[model samples]
Target: MLTSIWQAVRRAVRPFAAAVVTALLGVVLLSGWLDAVDWPASGGWVRAHLPALAFFAVAFAFAVQGIGRVVRADRPARSRPVGLSWWVVVLAAAIVVVAVTGATEWLLAEADHATDRGAARVDAIKTGLGVGAGTAGIFALLLAVRRQIHQEHTAADTVLDATEKRVTELYTKAADQLGSGNAAVRLAGLYALARLADNHADQAETVLNVICAYLRMPHGRLSPEVSDRHESELQEAQVRLTAQRILGDRLQRFSQNPTWGGQVDLTGAHVAGIDLDFAGLSYARLDGATLIRASLQYADLSSASLVEADLSHAKLTRADLEDADLTDANLAHADLQGADLTDAKLTRADFTGARLPDGMEFRNGLVVRT
Candidate 1:
């Protein structure tokens, strides 16, 4: 116990001891006492400004301590109390007061060519005391302001932390609901995620990714045969349609509603007869997916991959298909009028009876001059 107490005391005194040593070293250097070749002029200057130099050394030591504390990553400055203690503040003020008094008296004596022992000396002391007190008050006010600003920042950080935690909780809960067996529950989850994404712009891409992933999951098409399986498939199709609608709503650029401009991953997704007109689907992946008769008019499909995808009888008027890959894609009877197909890959693509862009025609499964 005694040894532990001694260790704690040593730790407490270490910083103070270091500061004192630094201050003494600074004073010795300023005094030019350790000069290898002492100059008389340098010595005279040091003697003339001894008091100010001593104060500067003490200030330098304090500054070094403050900087060391700030740079020490192990301990945050916020963890400790800010500003000097009452006694330290009083001592600093007193030192300034005494220095100012002595300087004032010396100045008056030199100017008047009189002795430094009279009413003039007393007046100088009064003037010095008033100036020093005012300076101290100003410093105290600045410290108070700094403390207030720090407190406000801390409060803001706390609120931000709480908000992030709440958002995370909501996100996790909504994601879990997406895996529910009930179609209604899944639909609710989709809307919840959409709302969350709308409110938090930073999480919009993540939420959209989740939606795309859900759509990418396998789901059977509605069957003609009337049975329990058909009903279940129909219900599942409704859920899928809802998910598609959500994506369409956010992807539409012309719509007044908020649009999500992130890249969509619908690779191998079988979303047939979907309506995604005026949607911003830049860099979307629709490889090997079934999108027959899909309405994609005025859509931004720039840099998108639709390799081997079926788009038979799809409406794609005025669509932006720049740098898109439609290799082996079925675009039979699909509208391509006014569409921008610059740098698009149409190798082996079936564009039979499709409305081609002006000055272009389908020949040998590729776009060529009419």
Candidate 2:
């Protein structure tokens, strides 16, 4: 196979090589013996005629080929064309070769006409294509680089678009699944939606509220220590607690539609952060309950039972604690600033840091007898 390929290449090369040698020999002879010919004069001639000769060569070739291509193209040309390929290089090179041949003959003739050219061979080599071709090449290179960069960036764009589409699909499917599914899937999906969704998306907050109400725990309260599957209700009773906060406690009591907390006795219930900020909880039995950090600021706790309750850090500022139970309650660090404590039982109650009506300060672990 190698021998056959070698034979085929040689046969093809023989005629082309013979033509090239003959052409070169002819040029050498025409210019006189190649070694004896003056190259310095030829170089000088080349430098002088380079610019004009190069321009004519490229302009003529482009005009002829570009027009012929447009006339013969099968497809109709659009207003803005796509781009061309490497074949442009081949065409331009061919044009340059032809022009160089013509210029060489012209140079020889001119040299013969002008007598004293002392050792100057009068060469008409037109090799330099000028800045026009260089600028075009640079532009083509920039376009090529831009195309490559665009191709690279396209993959990232596709991935991003696909990710966004997938997230949307997942959101839609989850919502659909939660609608007509079992309590477990529905609950799970609802919880998932709440976590993953944007703030207040697709009524997720409302859905959790609905589920909590359906279980009838006053709020969303599951049985204590149960794993959401055993028995019924929201796990930590936080559902009802959240509902009470979300749907106001006063509104629940006063609502035309009655709720569970309204009917049930909440006489000593430790409802902190329940927004009872300035509520009237008078005569309520709230003894020994953890009212720690409760916002009872400005609340009317007059005649209320607050015996031994952990009112530490409770906001009882300006609260009416007149005639209220105050026996041994940890009122340590409780803010009683502007509070009216005129006649309340204070047997062993820590009134530390609690302010009095007459600017009287609460001492270290002691309520001062006025």
TM-score per model over all chains: 0.71, 0.33
lDDT of 2 by residue, 209-312 (tens): 44333333232323346574533344334433443353233322334532222111233445444454555566756676656676777877788787878788
Give the per-residue Cα lDDT of candidate 1 at 247. Answer: 88
In model 2, which runs have C-alpha deviations exceeding 4 angstroms? 1-237, 243-270, 355-358
Q: Rate the local accuracy (lDDT) of all candidates.
A: 0.82, 0.58
Residue 324 Cα positional deviation in candidate 2, in Å, after optimal superposition: 0.7
Judged by whole-model lDDT over C-alpha atoms, candidate 1 comes out at 0.82
Candidate 1 ranges with C-alpha deviation above 4 Å? 1-123, 223-230, 256-259
lDDT of 1 by residue, 1-370 (tens): 9999977986767567656755775576567554433334454688999999999999999999998776575654565346656545555555565455445544454335446457665776677667677767777887888788878878988999999999999999999999998888888999999999989988899999999999899877654455667555777888889988988888888878564657888988888878899998888999988898889999999999999999999999999999999999999999999999999998899999999999999876677977
Backbone clashes in model 1, listed as residue pairs = none
Model 1, residue 210: what's the lDDT? Answer: 96
